[model samples]
Target: MTQSADEGFTTRQVHAGSDARAARPRALPIYMTAGFPFDGFDDAAAHFDQGDGFGYTRTGNPTVDAVERKIASLEGGAQALLVASGQAAVTVVLLGLVSAGEHIVCATHIYEGTRGLILDNLARLNIEVDFVDDVNDVAEWESKIRPTTRVLFAESIANARNDLLDIASIARVADGHGIPLVVDNTFATPYLLRPIEHGAAIVVHSASKFLAGQGSVLGGVIIDDGRFDAVRSGALYPHLTGTGRLGGSSLAERHGGLARIAYLRETVAPRLGPTPSPLNAFLVGQGLETLSLRVQRQSENALIVAEWLSTRPEVASVDYVGLPSHPHHALAGRYLARGNGSVFTFTLRGGIDEARSFVEALRVITHMTHLGDVRSLILHPGTTSHVRRTPEEREAHGVLPGTLRLSIGIEDSADLIADLSRGLDASHPPLETVEAVREESGALDVVVAA
Candidate 1:
C-alpha cells in the first residue's frame, strides 16, 4: 500500500513493501539475481555513473533494497542501507562519517562484539573510541567530547545487559553540540522502540536478530534520520565533503537527506565489501512479515520469566527494564511500545563457575553465544561474549562474572520458567561459602552482590 502514509505498525509491516497484483504470490518473491540486465551501452554508463536502481550485487540488489526500503519506512528514516552484519553497518557508518583522526563517544554498555570492533579492530585504523557508562551523568558524555569527536553512539537497549539509555536526553546533548546520535536498536527492534521518534539521528540493527525473528539469516540495516547537515559537518566526512573518490560524485551532492546511507551503499560498500547475500536478505524479508507478532510474544514471555527468576532463591538480581526494580524501568515504559525485549541479564547465587555450570545444566534453553533466536538461549557474557575483557573492564560495563544473559524465546512462559528453575537448582553454590566470601570482602555495597 505504498508505505501506508497513515497506518498502524502491523498494517505497515504487512503492506509497506508489497504491490499486490491480479496474480499476487502468497509469499514475497526472492529476486535472487546477481546483476541486473542493462538497457544499452549508454544505459550501462548511466547506471554505473548514477549508481542507483541496482547495477550489481556488490553495488545494489533489488531484494536487499526492498528490505532496506521497508526498514526505512518502519523506522521513520529517509533512507536505509542493508549490509552483511550489524558490525558492518557500524563500520560503514563510522568510516563514512569519521576519518582516522576523528573520535567517537560510545556507551560502555554496548555489545561486546561491537566494543571489540571499535577498540580492537578499528583501533589499528587510527580510530579512537571513548566509552562512558550509559547511566553516567549526562555531563560525562559532554566531558568526553573533543574537537575531533564526530558521532555520539549508543544502544537503545544495551545488549546482553538491560541498561537502557536516556535517548531523548542524549539526543538533546548531541543536538546542543551539533552532532548526530547513532543508536544500535538491535535488542529493542522497531516494534518495541523506534529510536528516531525519540531524536536518534541514525538507527542501526543486527537484522540477524529480532528483525529476522529467527536465527536463519545474517543481515544488518542502517537507517538515516536525515536531520544532520552534511554541508556544515562535511569536513569530518571526506567522502561527503570531497569530490567522489569511490564513485563519480559524493552522496551529499546527489542525495541530501540520504547522503550518509547512499554514500555507504555506493562508496563504502565497495571498499568495506560487506553486502548481505540475497538468500539472507530473502530470509529476513520473510521474518519481517511477522516481526510484530514474534517480538510481542518474546517480550511477554521475557516479562514472565524475569518475574519468575526474581522470585527464585537461587537468583540474585534481574537486569530487565520490564521489572519495576530496574533502574531504567520507567524510561523503558516510555520508550518501548511493545515491551522491554526478550534479552535480559540476571545473576546466579554463585559466581562465574556456577554461572557456567548452570548454563551447562540447562535442559530446554540452548547454551549459545547468539540471542534473539526462536528457541530459548542462555549465555554467560563474562565467559562467552566478554571473554576478551579483563575483570576490571567487565565490571566497568556492569557484567559480573556470575551474570547470565538470557534470551527468552517464544516458548510458553511456564515451560521457560521450569527450565530456568532446573538451571538455578544446579548452579547455586553453598550458602556458608557465599556468606564467608561476602564477609571477607567486607563491603555489601557492590553491584554484583546479587
Candidate 2:
C-alpha cells in the first residue's frame, strides 16, 4: 500500500513507507546486517556485473532506503539518499556536482560549520567558493557566477540567525545559468518550508538536528527534486554528462533529472564511506514519525520566547523572522508559510562578559553548541560557532561580541521565558563594580587633601 501523492505532510511523514513489507509491524524494523548473502554463481554475477541488487550494505541497505523514501516523499523530491552525518551530506553533494577547477557561489548567511567546510576544506580541493553578501539580492548571486560555476547553494533558514533566502528568485538565477540550486533545509525542515517546491533543484538536511528531534544519532539527507537538466548542460557538468566511467551510460543519461543524486549514490558516497548505520537510520525514522508535532509546538514556543526577550531591557535585538521587528520579516511571510522556524540569534546588552554571565545563569536552557534539539539550547556565536572567523568577518555576519544564538525547543513557553529572565538579571554588571569605582574616586580626593 504505497502512500498516495495526495497525502498531507503529517500523514506522509508517518505512513509513507510503512506498508512496504508484506506484514507491517507497529514500528519499522531495522535491517541491521552489514552484508546480504548473494544467491550464488549467476545471481552473484548479475549483482556484481549489472548493478542489480544490494550485494553490499555500503552501496545500499533496506533500512536506509526506506528512510530515504519517507524523506523524499516529505520534501516532494524525485529521490533521496541518507548519509552518515550532515557534514558528509554537504561534502558528498558538493563533490558530486563540482570537480576541481570548477566554482560554487554560496550565500554568506549559512551555518558556521558549513562556512568552514567551504572556506577551508573545499579550497584545498581547488574548487573555488565565493559567497554573496546579500542572499536576498538576485544580482549579488548573479554577480558571483563565472564560466566555471556549477552550483548555487544557500540555506532555506540559516541556523545562526533565522535568515530567509528567496528560494524562487535564486533558483531562477541558477536556471538562467544552467546550474542547480542546492539548499540546506536543515533548520526549516520540510514542515516549515520545502525548498524544492519553491524552484530549488536540490535540498539537503542535517537530520541530526530537528529531524532527529532528540539529537540522538547523526544523519543527513539529500533530496533531488529532479528538475535540473544535467544532460543539457554537458559542457558545465561533463563528469555527469560524459560516457560512464564503467563504459555503459553516463550518469546524466541514466538518471536524467536526478543525475546528481545518482552520482552521489554510485560514485561519491560509496568511496567516501558516509554510509549510515541501520540503527542510526532507525533512530532518525523514529524522529520523523513525530516531526510535525514537534516542529509546530517548537515554532510556537520559539515565537513566544523571542517576543518576550525583545521587550526586556537586557536584550538589544532579536533575529527571529517571526518577530515583526526583524529586517526580513516580509521575506519570511513570502517564503515561510507554516512557521518561521525555531532557531534565531539575539544580542545581549553587554559584551562577551555579559554573555558569559547569562550562559552561566541559565537553568532551564542548555548552553551547548548544538541546535534543533528537544531541549532549548543557547550559545555565544562569536566564541563558539564563529570563533574561527576574524572579528571583522564575524561582525559582518552579525556575530557581535555580545550576540547569542538560541535554538528554541519543544519546552514550555513560560518555563523558557522564566529561565531567560534569570539569565538577563545575572547578565548586568554586579553592584560591587559601581561601589569599587566610587571608592577609587574617594581615594583620589583624599590624596589631593593630603
Candidate 3:
C-alpha cells in the first residue's frame, strides 16, 4: 500500500501509497478513525512502544501516511509529516530543532504567520530567531551563526513577494556549520523547485495553497531529506543528540536516515501535536494529481500579468524572478528549472490608498487572504498579512505601503491583464503604459510575457 519517489511525478501524485481499494472507489477514501483496535496489551505496546505500523490517528493513520508518502516522494525526501495548518508545520519543525535559549536564523521575507511564529509563539518557548536580510550572501549568514544556532531557514520563493533564494549558497553555509537547512517551499512547491535537490536537508510546505489548488483545506507538510548529520553534531542539537525524554530512547538511534521525521512523529508531534485530518490529507492528495498542469498554467498566466504590470505607469516596481531584470534572475535558471512560481508583488505609483483602490477595483481576482487557487487573488501585506510588524520592521524587509502581492491562477492572460488594467487605470489615470521611457529607471519592472 506504499509507493516510492522513483515513480514519475504525475504517476506518484496519483498512485503513490494507494492500494487496490483506493481504485475500487476511484477516489482516496478518508479513514476517519480516532484509534485502531489492538488484539491484546502486548499488541498495543508493540504498536506504541515501537511503531509496528498504524495505531491511532493522533500518532499515525493510513490516510495520513498515504498523503505523507505522496508528498515525500514528490519532494524527493526520505519521509514526510502532515499537520493542521502552515503555522502548525512551522511550530512543530522549529520546536523539534531548537529548545529554550537556542537560536534560529530565518530569512526576513518569510510569511507573516511564520514571522510571528518566530517572534511570538517560539519566543514564549524561549527559542530566539535572528532574521537576516541578505539571504544570498553566505558570509552574512556565517556572521549570525553562534554556538546556540540550531537551524537555517528560508523560503524557496516567498509568499506574496517573488525573490529567489540562493539555496545552494545557504545550504553550503549550513553544511559548513553542520546545521540543517530548512527551506519553506510553499510558493515554489515541488513542481517548480525541490529544495532538497539543491542541498537543503529538509523542505516544508503550506499544503493549503498550490498543493491544495483550492481554498478549502488548511494543511502543512514537512519533508525530511535524510542527509543531515544530527548524531555527529551532538554539541548543537541536544534535543536530538543527547535526549532521553521519551522512555530513554536516544535521538541518534531512533531517528537516523529519516531521523528528523521519526523524532517528529514519535516525540515532538505527540507533544506539539497538530495532526491533519484524513479528509484534509485526502483532499490535498487529490489536489496533488493536477499540480503540474495547474501550476504550469498559473505560472504562464503570472508571467503575463507581471509583464503587463511592468508596462503600466501606475506600477512603481514589479518583482517577479521570471523577468530577466530581477537581481536573482541568473540563479532562477539554476534553482527553479521547471518554472518561476506564480506569486509575486508590485508597488503602485500612489501609496497605500492607490494600492487599496487597485485591489478593490479588481473584478476577476478575488479580494482574499488565500492564494494558489484556480482563481486569482490580491492583497496588501502592510495592512493584512504583515500587519503585526511596525512600519520600521516592514520597510526593513522591503514591504512598502504601495506594495501589492498577486497570486495569479489559470485564467486567460488577456482577461487577467484586462482586469488588472482596469484597476491600474482607476489607481492612476491620465498616464499611458511606461514602455519606452521607463526602461532607464532600472527598477525591476521587466515584462515577462509567455
Candidate 4:
C-alpha cells in the first residue's frame, strides 16, 4: 500500500518504505549481498560518479535504505543513515561534522558507551568534549560552548535516570552559537518525542533497543533534519564547506540541505566500514511495525511499577519521569506527553547488598543490562553500567550503590507487580520483621509455649 506524507505515525511505519509496484513482497525483503551486479561499464561509472546505485553494501543496501527511509519519516527528518551500532552513529556524526581540535558540548547524563566515546575515543583524536552538568540550565550549556564547538549533544530522555532534556531550549542555545544540536532519542524513541519537531537538527538512535523492540539486533541511525546549513553556520564545519576529497565541489555546494548526511554516507560511514547488515535492517523494520504498541504498553507498565516501588519502605527513590515525585516530571509532562518511556532507575534503602538480593530474587524479570526488551530486565548501574566512574562522579549523575535500573516490559501489570513483591520481600524480609513484631507482642511466644 502507498502511504501519504501526512499519514499518521503507525500508518507511516507500516507503509512508508513499501514499494507496492515492485514484486509485492508484503514484508520488506532483505538484500543480503556484499555487492550488486552492474549493468555495464557505463552503469558502474555512473554509480561511482553520482553515488546513485548500490554497487556495494557498505555504500548502500536496498533493505537498509528502506529502514532508513522509514526511520527518517518517523523522526520527521530529511534523511537517515543506518550504521552498525549506536556507537557508530555517534562516531560518524561527530567525524562528519568536526575535525581534530574541534569541540563538542554534551549533556552529562547519557549512555555510558557514548560518554566513553567522547572522553576516550574522540579525545584520542584531539576532539575535546565538555559536559553540561545541568542540561536544563541554558547558561551552563552556553558557557561550555567554545568557538570551536561544532555541536551540542544530548539525549531526548536520558537512560536509566529518566532526566528529560529541554530540547527546544537547548536547540535555541545551539542556534545562538550557530551550532547544531544532535540528540540521541533512543530512550524516548520517536513514539514519545520527535526531536526534530522540537528544534533539534540531528536525531540518533540505538535501533537495538526500543526501535527493534525484541532486542534481537544491533543497529543505529542518524537522522538529519537537513537544516544545519554548514555554509551559513560558518567556520563550524570547514570539512563540509571545503572541497570534497572526491574532487568536484564542497559537500555544502553539492548537496545543499543534505550536505551533512551526504558527507557521512559517502565519506565517514563507508570509509569507517560500520555498515549494518541487511538482515539486521530487516529486523529493525519489522520492529517498527509495532513500535507504538510495545512502547505504549511498556510505558504504562513502567509507571505502574515505579508507583508501586515509590510506596515500598525498602525503596529510597524512584527515578521515573512519569512519577509526580521525580524532579523532571514537569518537563516530562511538557515534552513526553505520549509516555515517560520504559527504562528508569530506582534506589533501595539497603544499598548494593539489597539491590543484589532484589535482582537475584526476581523470577519473572530477567537480570540483564539491556533495555527495551519484551521481557522485563534489571541491572545494577553502580556495579555494571557506571563502574568506570568514581563514586563522586557516579553520585553526581545519580547512580548510587543502591540504585537498580529497570527496563519494564509489556507483561501483565498484576503479574509484574507480584513478581516485584516477591523480590522486595526477599530483599527487605518483611515476613521475618512481622514475625519478630508478633513475638515481641507475646502473641507468637504464648502460642509457642502452649
Q: Pick the candidate with the highest TM-score.
A: 4
Give the Å shift of residue 272 in candidate 1.
1.6
* lDDT of candidate 3 over 1-450, digit per residue (tens): 477768779988876755545345667778888987787889988986778877789898888888999999999999999998887888888888888998999888888888888888889988888878867888888899988898999999875557789998899999888889999999998999988998999888889999999879999999998865765676776666665754576667666666667778777887877988899999999999999999999998988888888887778788899988778889899887778989998888778888877888999988899889989999898999878779998777667999988899998999999999889876776534554346645444444331
lDDT of 4 at 60: 93
Tens-digit per-residue lDDT, 283-376, candidate 2: 9999999999999999999899989989987888898899998878998888877788899999988799999989999999999978889999
Clashing pairs in 1: none
**Model 1 regions lying over 4 Å from their true place:** 1-26, 245-250, 429-450
- Candidate 4 Cα lDDT to native: 0.90
Clashing pairs in 4: none
lDDT, candidate 1, 288-321, per-residue tens: 8888898899999999999988988777789898
Candidate 1 global lDDT:
0.82
Candidate 3, 431: how far from true, in Å? 7.5
Ten residues in a row with the worst lDDT in model 2? 15-24
In model 3, where do residues sit more than 4 Å from their true spots?
1-25, 246-249, 431-450
Q: How many residue pairs clash in each candidate?
A: 0, 0, 1, 0
Model 4 ranges off by over 4 Å: 1-22, 431-450
